[model samples]
Target: MNKKILIVEDNKTLAKLIAKKLQSALGLTVDVAYSMAEAKLFIARYTYFIALLDINLPDAPNGEIVDFVTEKNIRTIILSGNIDKEFRKKILKKNIIDYVNKSGVDDINYIIHAIQRLQNNAKHKVLVVDDSRVFRKQMQTMLENLFFQVISVAHGEEAIGMLKSQPDISLVLTDYNMPVMDGLELVIEIRKTYTKNELCILVLSSNEDEEITALFLKHGANDYVKKPFSKEEFSCRINNSIEALENIQMITNYANRDYLTGLYNRRYFFDTINEYIDEVKNSGEKFAIAMIDIDHFKNINDTYGHDTGDKIIIALADILRSSTNPHDIVARFGGEEFCVVLKNINQYSAEEIFNRLREEVEKFSYHLKDDKYINFTVSIGATLFNEEESLEENINAADMLLYNAKKNGRNQVVFQA
Candidate 1:
């Protein structure tokens, strides 16, 4: 949620600096309070994402502000000039996110980083697996406080089923001691579907044995956390794993996607289509392959320059994307050309679908730099896949039909039934 963060500090200078830093860095609305009274007023007036509370306020001394804020069920971060270990431990015992020593700019930087982490955590969903209801609830509470969408399961078998249903899960936090199946077995099973870079698996257990850690890691666990983990440790590990996963996926996308169109590149398209063919070879699922190219694309590039040509390409990609089913494969085969697989469809229906797509393209307009609009059209050639033919052979037939469409006339769909 894009919400406000409340800063309750008795130091006006420090509070304003924190507010400014937070506002500039995160682009979030921040309210600064000079004392506990002012903080209470802000809290009653507005709901905050999280509250940053100073330990010793002008009116409420001895870190009483922490108690008041936490009692209100607000997630808090304690800011104190005091750095005594015993005092820090006592303050952290409360439900505050972290105890920050207000030493200087570094402490302010820490707050910024923590807020950014929490914001990024919102885009991720974490699965919590534990046989014990108490532990499950505990992990769920912690994960939610850290801004994750959490789904907790009692054991490995249920976790597997949940993962199947929720394929978008980013990470799994599983406990080793569980019924139905253990964490190690869960790790092995999950790895069959998702790779280490695609999904992260973290094992949590009371067993501090080194062998258990090795066993989990060897079996595909990304990392291991012992029982009674401090909030900081847990947060760091979880965020690190997710960060790594995102980085890897980003790199993979760059490799497998067309940079300009954001569609599957030719290499990935063929690879995916080949896998689909293998899956449906025995099932007799009908599909159609289509080759599409813009009408007179090179002439447009010559008249308007390649920059405008790129814009036209991107616009056509959007049309193709919105016009197709989610399960359908749409890829940018190359410059000014694309490919699509109409899955679970007959020849007649596929022809109708492509004709509608062609109509949508014909009726579309791209506004030019001179306040004028330019209209473009495309020619599509489609054919039903023949089980007797190889993937390359079927594609070649579609390509020949595309040539015929270009030869006969552009801006139309040609289907070879």
Candidate 2:
């Protein structure tokens, strides 16, 4: 399909000429609007891939038209006769893709090149949550010009559903003050379910006061942009916020990873288990937990020193990690202790996995610094989590089963009744 371009220009001759050139050169179908009102009407009536806009129009001056176009999710190139350097600088700050002063044929050609560039660049996906339709539309425009797929919701509830539907959303721009659920409340709810890396949030505020900014940041917002914000400045802040989120996520993944096992650490394990419980609670799906302990670990530690014990632990972790499927949650619970939480599996399958792990652990060998080969074994206890059971109860049941394995001669697997 040929790209649609809306030309918001008061000069009929210029508008027609630009439209002709764009249609002839770029194979674009152009729509002309002599005023902001007509432009808005055209916008509501049809979807334009891009908008060629003049900062000043008869109905609304001072780039209000640009703001309107931006809200509509239309990529815009400012085509204006206005020569105020300060004003142009201000619009550039708002993240409008490009600004071209009213010029000759060459400038129009440059504008077409800019539009082509916008089409070729990567498209960011933004979810805008705001009670105000006005605000949502504004962000939609700015984002579209930068080649972003934009989804806007008028309230927090709708925003949540939208986020659930589009899991790949790159960022969310939400208003601080709104009906039903406000921005801070929304952020809190989202954080409770999703990781900080999974979603990047920015609070929009009419008030740019330090207290207000600090309050939103405290509530887990990535950043804040004041209302009546300069376009260029808002763009810079959003880009920086995304970069910061990527860095933070990288650090978080490393910090929550076990050094020896390459599995999740105790902290990440706990966090993930809780999240799993939350997910299963709503679905009533059956899950299993297993507690594993290296049998006679203390004797090994005393006989070969702590270094040998450490090598054995690392080797055991590697065995368990390689034995389990990707869906399985294997973690070094602590010391010689480890745990696995299997989802969508019943007690029988859990016991089978437990037996397999026991056999693997028994067969595994480790090497000490003196190049001496050492063999070790592990005991495991498994339990099925009931819908009514707490995580602690589930853990206790698994631990008790592990104790039974140790009691019934080590290197065995036991299941809770």
Candidate 3:
């Protein structure tokens, strides 16, 4: 089912506007409730991913709806016209995702952004490191409220271990003062492995020293949050940092991936394989490089048309991706041709893998349209790498083997014994 949202605001105009924007921008199904009773009925009928509640409803004037939705375990963000500092503080203390003052267009835009951030948060893991157990727990709760998977450690040492074990962690929130290692030292050490684009580090400190903040940023911290930060400011900073990282990642992915097949492009394959070769050279490990080509690809394109040929190529790419191990590097070399690097594998294992893949492709059938179908197969040529040989030499060997495979017959695995 599509994720749905609920907007409970007595102002019919503003509520519908918010709903419309959400529907158009995020493709979310939004249900608008003009009163607390209507919202209750909607809540009972369908599960909502999040709800935007007004502080003063006709029936629940004192933000009673916040409690009602929270009781259902639905995430809540308040859209109230009240900008009173004490009231905002009180509402923020209630463990809501965010409390937006519905006073202007910018605030509504903020609400939209917060929702987007929340959606992205589900894909990220955050690590919170602090010597104070209370602060660590507090930050963890806040991060969790933003829909992030949060792990809290009591000190910087533990944080380092966590990062080592959980390489998927996207953000680290650490305190300045800690036992064993401080946040600054942790940032310095983390920078040794991960760049700012790869991992986001945010420093949280009560210290008012400018040099301290500068030091953290100079070392590698992406941003800093003062200890007594407001809920809105904290949420904004965290989201901004995460969003920036995501943008960088998206650009990197576009650069590395083939536009059509979504596999690593030829350039990326060479770049990555060079590094892999270097690592293998140091470890004295054997690897295999395979060059794959679809058999009779030009004939298929000339007979069935280029569109159908494209479909066949896509189907074959899917097979290559699924048939290989996760650690293997798969790439689209160009039209109807592909390459893969199988790490720590001998010639025997490489042959077995490619033969299995060829069998699967030969057995598989492709449907073009209603009552129309086509079938295709692949020819593979692979070579086990010798650390002493150059990359160009290994590639040439694989290409020669591939040519021989085509010369003998199609749908075969050719490799050096």
Candidate 4:
């Protein structure tokens, strides 16, 4: 339950400093081991999110510690005094997250940054497309070391199929030459469905042709790497691309989400619902739209205060989020009013889902000062959409039903029946 980091360095002073910084800056539990034997003991006792290891330990001077820790499946970033080209390449081939030279303060800073980056990497998924089974497996292992969920395919066509199946995939690493579809064609096709900000593409090639690299970049690739790249260079490029995409996504998300509860804003909800309708029009799939409002929300505001009311609204938002499918859209229409769009469902199923949510809200008791407590309820109105109907008509019908639910009773779901 506790997030911890292990530091394995013979230099006591340096080890203490690193542990201090990790504890103070990141609030992680830090354990320091001065030798390979000690490090193994720590590894056996506690699970670590990551480990920082000095290559030349007293007990294991030939970088045996790297193999020992990595074999345990703990993510590692190696610290080394030697930066020889061959030595670095050999270290990288071992599938460590990264290897940093122990030079100065900048190196320590890089370690800190790498730790943060790996933490963020847990939320991302990367797709690796290579024709060679050996190359694909190698890449998957490297990516897994960096704490990313990897989906690998043999060729570009399978890569596209994977992308369609997993829309949340954040990065694509593709080989230039393949059987079914080549990398260049794959990048061009991917760009058609996903924009530059939504997905990042990295091309790997043995081709020395300058024009090929330029062409891939011109088309849609975010970065290009030569086949024989050092582990440092490969990890750095991948991290840079993913970081840039995440920054852009953060800004775009803020624009689309409500400022209060972090749910989709009203405008985004409308736009997405229209897109959803367009998507299902030819398939003859049914969907439902629901409008939900907190019952007597103003009374809660008057009794407890606006702060408590906001908490209640946020609580209800959490309920809606947990109750619906990921494909279903839940948004804050405004104030105490919320909206949800249920996909691939009829009026009956939608009613069942919303009624369950209503029961959850009723069961939750909000605590106040001096052991005081209060309960809240929500009224929901929903309607199934017909292919002949428009978005506005469905919303209006749902809204009218919601109004009727509030009028008839405080806590209930009102639909066709």
lDDT of 1 by residue, 114-141 (tens): 8888888899999999999998898888
lDDT of 4 at 366: 87
- lDDT against the true structure, per candidate, is 0.91, 0.81, 0.90, 0.90
Candidate 4 lowest-lDDT run of ten? 385-394
Please give, for residues 147-198, the per-residue lDDT of candidate 2 as tens digits: 7688999888888888888877878899888888888888888888776677
lDDT string, candidate 3, 10-127, tens digits? 9999998888888888888999999999999999999998999998999999999999999898899999989888888899888798877788778777778878889889999999
What value does the lDDT take at residue 330 in candidate 3? 95
Worst 10 residues of 1 by lDDT: 90-99
Order of candidate numbers by TM-score, starting with the best: 3, 1, 4, 2
Model 3, residue 226: C-alpha shift (Å): 1.6
The clash number for model 2 is 10
Alpha-carbon RMSD of each model: 2.2, 13.7, 2.1, 2.9
- Give candidate 2 misplaced runs (Cα > 4 Å): 1-162, 166-170, 173-198, 202-221, 224-236, 243-284, 299-305, 325-328, 367-372, 386-394
Candidate 4, residues 320-344: lDDT per residue as tens digits?
9999999999999999999998899
lDDT of 3: 0.90
Model 3 has a clash total of 0
Compute the lDDT of residue 137 as modeled in candidate 3.
84
Q: Is candidate 2 or candidate 4 better by TM-score?
A: 4
- Candidate 3 similarity to native, TM-score: 0.93
